[model samples]
Target chain A: MTGALIAGIAAGLLAAVLHFAFVQSYILLGEQYETGELVHFQTPADHATEDHAAADQHDHGSHEHGDEPSVLQRNALTVGFTVLLYVAYGMLLTAGFAIASQFGRKITATEGALWGLAGFVAFQMAPGMGLAPELPGSAAADLTARQIWWWSTVVATGGGLALLAYGRSILTVVAGIVLLALPHVIGAPLLDAYYGYAPTEVGAIFSSRVLGVGLAVWVVLGWLAGRQWDRGAAA
Target chain B: MTTTTQTKTQSLLAPILGMAVIGLTVLLAVGHAQSATLHDAAHDMRHATGFPCH
Candidate 1:
């Protein structure tokens, strides 16, 4: 547990840095559109002509706007919160390792990374298939409904993956597959129509970048947790 | 020594599961269930981490 905490804190710091470098600018840009500080194409036809428009907007949004002060200020808290989030994720990973160890399976750093990948699949990739990383002004389904669906997806995916990883029996494997498929089959809550203040491209880039950051963070987290936990066990 | 090690392993499971529960509660609170004020404060992070957000 101590090892996981240490690793989680380290990974959290890394996550904060990665996010600041890659993801935050787009968030700021998306917010501008959300607040009407920036505007996108007025009609569907306008959207067809300028695919690069969102990228151009983001470039200026990052530089000329002189957003450095606020970005720095927000990131101070972001650093702390991000660290805490990873620490919690560490606990979950540690729990997974503990369960595996009880079954006489030893966790190596490589295996830890695989566990981290499983975490990514369960929490971000799977749910992301339906909801995605949304922008500020993006229209979403009811918050509560989204939350419910999100939780069910995480639990189902996590449990399913666990069963797949540890199950010795074909029946358990089938059950795991069923659990994995259940959430996607039920579907994520969705708005009846497409809507948002930002151009679709901005939102698209924002989401893909978010997922990318998530994968990096989770893998690092798992590796660190595994290394530390293995050290602890050996001692 | 074997008995002692088995006992240690058994005892560890409860605390590990307990920690997981707490960790999950915190994840949900900050990620999904926080109030509007907290949301405003944590806005950039909320999105950066891929929590469902407004």
Candidate 2:
């Protein structure tokens, strides 16, 4: 159990750090293209309209903002915090699997992959499409059409996770159906205001697709992890 | 002697078959979840993540 817990934390941290770095690099790519002043920082609220207007005011187009290769600042604060998040996510994943393992029924490489896929579908992709907050400044944030699609994905992800966890049993299957139905009856806002849902067919569609792809990635990761576990067992 | 050998084989076969059957069911269920509707932008994002969305 201890080993599993440790592995889970380690894996979560690893993934979180990688994701944070990826996002940081993505942001820097945009920042490098600026011809005028550098946007060091801004609050989310001000970022939406004010910053965008300010950027437009300065006629500094793409060329002015030279295409600079981004550097991953090797600062203790940035790296430390990013890695910590990754570790936490890893711990969650590893711990989940660890608990599952205790059943002794065990999952195969394929099954583990499926489980991983299930996680991605439910967590990142689904939430992002709907229940998760969007980049406040983005066009998608304002588009009611897009918002609806996003929320649907959130509902889908949650239902999907429940199904993955308890799919084997008939009772579990029934529970999944009930869970899925809840969004319709309860109406969107699955959590609170921060997690408000938009009821839109298009948003639902978007959520499902995004989440599905995420799940596929998880499947691959899970497969790799399972194979490693198998090797360890064999040894 | 042959019967004993056959029994051993059956014992191994049972667990494998059970696992395979369960695995198949799971795959199908997951497939259904994947096939649900999706947005073009979100779909593209999924691809960016190197996932085969279809």
Top candidate on lDDT is 1
lDDT of 1 by residue, A1-235 (tens): 6887898899999998888778877776777677776678657675553454446544654434464446456667778778888888998899888888888999989999999999999989998998998888788998889889988999999999999998999999999999999999999999899777887777888899999999999999999999988988899
Worst 10 residues of 1 chain A by lDDT: A60-69
Docking class for model 2 is: incorrect
- Mind giving the per-residue lDDT tens digits that candidate 2 earns over A34-55? 3223332546774454345423
DockQ of each: 0.69, 0.04
- Please state the Cα-based DockQ of model 1 relative to the true two-chain complex: 0.69
lDDT of model 2 at residue B40? Answer: 24
Clash numbers, per candidate: 0, 24
C-alpha RMSD for every candidate: 3.3, 14.0
